[model samples]
Target: MLHYIENSKTQVGKELVLMDIGAEYHGYTADVTRTVPASGKFSPEQRVIYDLVYRAQEAGIAACKANNDFWAPHKAAAEVINKGLTALGIIKNETDKHPYFPHGTSHYLGLDVHDRGTYGPLKAGTVITVEPGIYIPEGSPCDRKWWGIAVRIEDDILITANGPENLSAKAPRKAEEIEKLMIEESAFNQLELPKLD
Candidate 1:
């Protein structure tokens, strides 16, 4: 994305991307996504929104545990996202349901990207994903302080006898961490390819 933004002449306005990646191994699947600034460093507006989703994802992951209701994570995540939006003055009130965040947090992960599992109490060893997002396009009802910014944080989690374990923990999720990763020299950076006429 940094390369694209730097190399291309396209002007950025209210454009955002929500990238989803899933890999299947041994019949099980993993799903995750991270939205970063195409310019490598998050702008002020983008940072706030990104942090909100990150904190919400953390809250959702904490709710994934044995014997807890399957929807607990979603509820937990929604509450955090709702309150954050309210506190940031992005929305009118925390009690008011906002369309900006309209998806559940967790789903089973197995044969399919959205694997099948009981909506009842979560059992130990259940693999799931905790993803929370916020999307605010240009010209929305809210203030311009929160426009053209879209963010989603996702991580694969596993229910354990004790608590939740993050399977994709190695992946960088924090704003600073992402910035660092983006700036690091890529393996392909030094390779030169000859242009064909």
Candidate 2:
């Protein structure tokens, strides 16, 4: 799906594209998502929100373990996100009631984007997605400096005997890395196309 944001107040805007891809090998499927700035470089406000979400995702990943329930990662990430919004003065109090962060931090990932059976303790072979996002719709009570910024960071994770493993870690998750990667030309760009009616 595509989410476009335009804000005169923040003096910046972005066409955010969110995609989920799945591949199968030996009858097993994997799902992953990567979000990047359409402009190739994040504005100051965008960077702030993106970084906060990145940190929250890290916390969520850390919570993935054989001993923790499926909801543990959500709880850990939500705590960080809620506190971050408050510390940035985006909200009135230290609470997770903020409308900006409305979704759970994770969900099962396998053959489907949201796989089934995400209820009890996580299993060692289970795969899940840790995605934390902030969406500030226009005309909110917050200052204009924080207007029209939306960011979502997602990674496919595996609960292992040692700890959580980021299967998509090779993908760029940081703002700088994303910007650099975006600027590089892709091999597909060189493909020749024939005019067919």
Candidate 3:
């Protein structure tokens, strides 16, 4: 997976891209991406909806326990995103923005991002990413109030005999959660600065 930020020289526009590529030794592939604001902060409205995406991701991970179907996480994440978005008045119904988040939540992770394996069910020792996202582009069918705002929360996971383990725990998914962590780290750095005699 790759995350990138780009600044425009001619325009007041910035771009962020997250790309995930999966290949399989037996012939399979899984690819996905999620773009977001790079300034470490989202607009007020964006935050409300973005939090929903984060929650969906967490729910997906939690559903990846042993004895679950390989597609369970995706279904769980999608339901969370749909219900959350609907409650926030962003989407009218669960299947509203089907075009944007049409892809599955988790895929096999090995040689390819969507590694080759049996898709029927999930067994212990499977790795994947549970990502839930919502994209609102200009002139979309939905309300224009949220145009141009895209939010996604993705995390790598490993299915275990007991449950699932998150691999990308280092990435921040919450608005206040991220802000607090960043602020604490910044303060720590200042305190560690060399003292001037």
- TM-scores for all candidates: the values are 0.88, 0.85, 0.73
| Model 1: how far residue 69 lies from native, Å | 0.7
Candidate 1 stretches with Cα past 4 Å from truth are: 1-17, 190-197
Q: What is the lDDT of residue 17 in candidate 3?
A: 37
Q: Candidate 2, 142: how far from true, in Å?
A: 0.6
lDDT of each: 0.85, 0.81, 0.68
Model 2 segments more than 4 A misplaced:
1-15, 20-28, 194-197
Best by lDDT: 1
Question: What value does the lDDT take at residue 23 in candidate 1?
Answer: 90
In model 3, the clashing pairs are 22-112, 22-113, 23-112, 23-113
Model 1 agreement with the true structure over 17-50: per-residue lDDT tens digits? 5567789899878998878677778888889888
Number of clashing residue pairs, candidate 1: 0
Of models 1 and 2, which has the larger lDDT? 1
Residue pairs with colliding backbones in model 1 are none
Write the residue-wise lDDT of candidate 3 on 1-197 in tens digits.
12224533343253223344333447633343344445545667677667777878888999988788878888898898788767767668877655646567776777666567888778888777787777666786767767767766677788889788876676555677665554554555566766789
lDDT (Cα, tens digit) per residue for candidate 2, span 58-93 = 999999998799999998988888888888889978
C-alpha-based local distance difference test score of model 1: 0.85
lDDT of 1 at 15: 46
